[model samples]
Target: MKKIEAIIRQETLDDLKDAMLNTFEENPIGMTVTQVLGFGHQKGLKDYVRGQEVITSFVPKIKVGFVLEDKCVEQMIDLIVKTCQTGNVGDGKIFVYPVEEAVRIRTGERGESAI
Candidate 1:
């Protein structure tokens, strides 16, 4: 199993979700979305605070997390990049990690089935 985490522009969440659901309709794809503040190469955005120009170090982003079978990882990444890419900085990043285990609290299901 793998855990895929994608940090994307706040505006792209709906399109990404719709695309993922349409492409993976054969199986249940559970995902978690979180509002986060982060900065990378772009540093941050310029804003006027009391008429003074300022660069806020942290910018708002949407972090979407998913745990799925290994077979789905590549396709998921592709969809994320395709849906979120805007030919601009702060479009965000995607990460994949090995999942040690997964468990369903209600039914006691484990492994891939639990996911």
Candidate 2:
């Protein structure tokens, strides 16, 4: 299995959900969505704080993550990129990892089944 982590612009969340729902052949996979703060080479931008303008090194982002079967990884990655791209800076990033294992506590489903 593979874990897909997408750090995307907060504004794009709704579109991402819609696109994912429309594209996947299987039932919708479960996901974890988190609001986070960080910066890249962009280092955020200047913004007014306490009546003063200053470089804000940290900015808000939405990290959407889920685990998928190996066969679905590439297509899902393409869907994510297609749905999330804004042709601008701070569009965010994606990360993929090999999932050693996963489990659903109540159902006791593990591996791909757990997903």
Name the best candidate (by lDDT): 1
State the lDDT of candidate 2 residue by residue for 1-115, as single tens digits.
Answer: 9999999999999999888888874677767899999999678889888999998889899999979889889988998899899888899999999999989999999888888
TM-score between candidate 2 and the true structure: 0.91
lDDT for model 1, please: 0.96
lDDT of 1 by residue, 1-115 (tens): 9999999999999999999999999896998999999999989999999999998999999999999899999999999999999999999999999999999999999999898
How many residue pairs clash in all the candidates, one count each? Answer: 0, 0
The alpha-carbon RMSD values of the candidates against the true structure, listed in the order shown, are 1.0, 1.6
Q: How far is candidate 1 from the true structure (C-alpha RMSD, Å)?
A: 1.0
Query: Model 2, which residues run further than 4 Å from truth?
Result: 49-51
TM values, all candidates: 0.95, 0.91
Stretches off by above 4 angstroms in model 1 are: none
Question: Model 2 residue 9 lDDT?
Answer: 93
